[model samples]
Target: MRSLGVAVAYPDPGVADELVHAVEAEADLYLALDPARAAVVLAGEEALSTLGEHPADAAVVGVAADRDAIAVVARAALRCGAHEIVLWPQDRAMLRSIVRDAATRARIGAGRAEGRIVAVAGARGGVGTTTVAAMLARAVAESVVVDLDPVGAGLSGFLSDGAEPTLAAVVAAVDDLDPAALSAAMAGHAAGRAICAEPREAAPTKQQAARMLALLRATVPVAVIDAGRAADDAAMAAISLADQTICVCTPDVASIRGARALIAAAGRGFPVVLNRSARMRLSAKDVARVVGAPPVAVIPDDPAIRRAGEAGRLPSRGAARRAIERLAGLILAEASDGS
Candidate 1:
């Protein structure tokens, strides 16, 4: 096992000495010269001001003197974004345990490859962006779908009954975000997990959106973001981070025009998926010509898919399901090749 680095930031020399002694007592733990390089940072109340300078992935353990000091410092720690609060002397064992766990997490994160992110955006509303995102997530192994759309009924309404600690909550804690915090915010679904947006909640800022996506990339094998139409800052943020952006649109004049504009704005060719294909006279080639790229997948207008969606489930077997599965395979292949 690799030794874990511990960094201490306490205003009082006596308290700092105690912290250093506790860390040195463990054979696996060693003092880190740079706080940013450490797996865990032990900070006293006054030292909490330096929290912003450390890496967000570092575990922050706030140290307080006693029960009385803990009460005062705990509240301050929460505001300053500490992950945990430890009482000096009394919680020495707990501190050691926290350091060990943090070390394990840091090692795992450093060893594993970062995940692929796919952003699904629609040419316009009602073009099946959410459906494509949800189905793609289901087809991909060890995947999660994130609902970044704020206007339409969230992706959770289509997949599950939406869980607590929504996207809004996650964005609010982006400054101190961790894999554990994000995992708790996800809702369970037969397809996979989802971080659904709360209805009518304010959109995430660009910084918050970027931070959330970064954490997701570090945590999951793959993440599919339902970016709606890619109109707002949050949607653009997802697109900016995505390894691939799938543009979904129907084979119609208006929809094709919208898709062309989106493709042009992207300044690069993106794979387009023709949703509800063969329902109109426009063929895949016609739509592809207008969109400046070939249709990667054509999902037929399947009644089974509609029926399954109405019941908040995906079609077990159908042409549409097979097409989505192929798309998922392509995404996985591209991600692997990139790696």
Candidate 2:
């Protein structure tokens, strides 16, 4: 919500009213003369060069005076990530219309906004990947946890309140997406978080999964994909699009082998999670040795985790609660640093 910097090189006062009103409507843009705190710059010949400019962080809204060619502005806008351009209109009504459209595009990139993708996949089935995913989602703020299970054992029953969640309905509706469609696909869990739980009775094609993940990142600031047990080609594609991957490993040798193969094969990084710590007959260090990195986190063995998943909330309070909080903080800190 930083203020937008607007430099009007239009050289005419005739269309000033219309242009000013247009930027006012959009909350994303703040019209401030101070160069230090601008989200966007309306650069023209005057002070533009003096501002020590060459694509500083702000998005640029280029305006040409008395020239009502928006199509020209649109091309330049896309290139520089400039949101919009308002041509000075002698007609007040036309100026208002142009500014409104430009404001809409400004919402796409904002510094305070967080853009992230974290995928959770188990070494194999029944190792608590889904439970950990729900926990991770619960820990983050303003984020969505999607159970994109292509094999489609829907995540609905895990919630304490039996709300049947299906992502298929939303995914099926979108071919090309923007922010608006993303908002529609998400539903609130009673536990005060959002989840996309869709039944995948028929397996989703690799192409479908790839497209879904692409569109999800296009709009939301943070996206958490929960890949239960096996990671199909589609799941692997999801991992490739991730900022990081959390591989849920138990202390069994077979699980460690599977996790190692997954890490070696993936395009990005793997952050190991040793779930259910106490029951593991093998040591975490031994397991980490196989996976190639020291385990980044270990969620201790706790029955409350099952209760957390069943209630559709992460284990907010537990014997191992500190570990969960630490993992959440690590992810958040990584995301913030990325910002």
Candidate 3:
């Protein structure tokens, strides 16, 4: 496993026990305010300026003098990307909740940046992980690509050929694969770009999956696996191998609750993309409250995407396309910054 890339800055050791716990054994924190460093821990509004010094992925906590000042601190903390802001008046219970939320967002943003492996799974069914995955697959796939879902799921039909070449072929060629070779095996997009979306009820084994993913990454700047409904060990392994995972959910209570676990299961990092959101059922704020972190991006309920799938056509260059393209840019930018 890669090191948990984290950076934390706390000037005072007032809460030494909690400080140690915040770092966690597996994570490598960039503690900015330690005595060893010439760091002076700033408080409240001043801390926002310090954000540029910290890695974009690091979770920051702004310690204030008291609870009453927390709201003021939190506003600045949000601007600084300081995930959480805390006050001495508060106890661990409330503080921990706030801190955890910020830390999780920090982790998620960082994870997705480096071609993060993500599994877009629906809570139960009909939650649209497939469609979300298919659109996202096109969004991230640049050079080399891998679509884990099988043909006939619109990914194959609309984005690429259903029967020509698939991720299955890439898996078969794993032993001798390189970036160029893997790129060759994927299905091509509108601009002659390639993708690997082979549907198999039994996905590749974990080790096999990892090796293939590693190889695919070597050739393609991005590799997207459409996990489909098969959220098995192999699929989980694929998701784990990813630098970040994107859990797709709807606004319904069931989808929200399921998305919560899916995001959590992806570990401390990985963004949650709310798909087909319904304001009547639940708002983005409601989803955020459930998931604890604001969704990296919220996609509205658009039937055109489904219609495009049924017609075996890529989503038109309309509202959905504009949103998706922008979403793609955000995802790619995040990838470049290692967020």
lDDT of each: 0.81, 0.62, 0.58
Q: Which tens-of-lDDT digit does each residue in 1-339 have in candidate 3? A: 122333334444565435545545324333344422312233345556666755555556676756676777777776765655666545444644454344444444454223344455555567766666656656664533355555334355644454464666666667765444655565666323544453433466677787776665444456556555446666677777776567777788888888777767757555667777655778788878988888777887787877776876657555656666676787778777876
Report residue 120 deviation for candidate 2 (angstroms): 1.1
Model 1 — TM-score against the truth? Answer: 0.70
Best by lDDT: 1
How far in Å is the alpha carbon of 310 misplaced in model 1? Answer: 1.4
The whole-model C-alpha lDDT of candidate 1 against the native structure comes to 0.81
Q: Over all chains combined, what TM-score does candidate 3 have?
A: 0.59
Which candidate leads the pack in TM-score?
2
Regarding lDDT, does 2 or 3 come out ahead? 2
Tell me the tens digit of each residue's lDDT in model 2 across 1-339. 224444343334654444556556556544555545554556433333343553354545666553555566556555555555555544344543343333333433332233578888888777777767766766776667777664645455454455556576655654554445556656766323445554555444567776566555544656778877645666776777677788988777888787887777774557888878885376688776787677788778888777865655566688666786688889888877863
Better of 1 and 3 by TM-score: 1
The residue-by-residue lDDT of candidate 1 on 1-339, one tens digit each, is 357789999888998999999899998889997999988888888777768898877767888887788877887788876767888888888777777555435534454326678999999888889888989999987788988887764576764654452787788888886676777777786468988886767788778888788777766788999999888898888887788998999978888888888878777778899998875468799986787668999898778888988888888899999999999999898887983
Q: What is the TM-score of each candidate against the true structure?
A: 0.70, 0.71, 0.59
Q: What local lDDT score does residue 170 receive in model 1, on the 0 to 100 scale?
A: 85
